[model samples]
Target: EDYRAKGFFKEALVNFVALLGWNAGDDREFYYLNELAEKFELERVNKAGAVFDIEKLNWLNAEHLRAKDPADLIEPLKAELNSAGIDFSGRSDEYLKSVIIAMRERVSFVKEYIEKSPYFFLPVAQYDETSKLKNWKPETGPQMLRLKEEFAKLGENPSKEEYEVALKLVATELNIGAGKLIHPLRLAVSGMPAGPGVYDILVILGKEETINRIEKAVSIL
Candidate 1:
């Protein structure tokens, strides 16, 4: 807003995407400062106020996140997580790699995964207070805890080999339906009632982080 009034649209446009709410990747991201005037298309621009729509921003973020290679996604996520005091280095890159896969559906931006899934880095400080009480039952916590314990024994990091075995065990023990278990588990770990596929979340967060989140949720209950 400051620079835009000064007739610096290019700098302001870049600034618009860099601050509190920024959409970093355009097909034009690769364009140099020298090419700004030629590449800049004013026709496609939307005129709007700064009353942020989370849904629209999140969808934009997901599109950008998906466009990035898994390996490439890690560096920026790592930088953000590090600034937030999360030790992504100690955790497996495989987990980080798969995390991109897990979160792309639910989150709109790189910052969002950190914001929404802070339990992956920090312990969850606040839960969805309304949903917490509305949805969580005493029995549900223990059921999830028991399943998480069993899930941990599968392997260090889940592979196709171990995942199949774990699914078989889940089918045998849980017996009722995977959705029943998955629903509660998703809520426990993410604090959202729904999200990207569960198996992938487990694969990315890894067994330890997944179990840690479950145990923390159970303790809170």
Candidate 2:
């Protein structure tokens, strides 16, 4: 229960502990509880001591997290959010699910969906210092203003593709690579150097919030 509270899935914990001093006489490491029951053999138990590998447990937990349906993660993720004192009252389940889908592969634990990407729930508190040094430049301010205009043209609820096109058009007019706008824009919206695709972040944030974040970044940075 404590492990579950801490975001380690029960199945993953079971799978990891099972491999401590035993193997199924093969390379396969993942198994369902039922499968473990069927495969366990007294003969395969090792005489040698087992080393507790926290890294392996983390890996297995991530694998299990990815294997489950994103919808199935919502309740537990909400629990984690509540425990963390994040108020998600206004956010819908479907919206939460989209966040899960976007961040699932990038995170190893349920809490990380919130930890690594708090911008989804709250406004950008602080820009990543490294990202500011690397992605934000003298020209980035004006470039972001122009990009904000393009995003404003998108109105509310623009698709990810539309956001991409808007960004590309800005890059073309500026006679710079798309990466120039992409990196700084990512910094503006996510306040981080990396995570999910920037366009996806834009769409998820919607038009008003995206523009507001850009405006905020411009003023602050």
lDDT tens digits, residue span 1-221, model 2 = 88777778899999988899889999999887889999999899888989998899899999999998999999988988898899999999998999999999999999999999999988899999998999899999999999999888875699989999999999999999999999999999999999999988987878899999999999999
> In angstroms, how far off is 61's CA in candidate 1?
6.0
lDDT of 1: 0.62
Name model 1 segments beyond 4 Å from true.
1-62, 92-94, 160-175
Q: In model 1, which range of ten residues has the least summed lDDT?
A: 3-12
Clashing pairs in 1: 17-22, 58-108, 61-108, 62-108
Where model 2 places Cα greater than 4 Å from the true spot, the runs are none
Query: Model 2 residue 71 lDDT?
Result: 98
Measured by lDDT, the strongest candidate is: 2
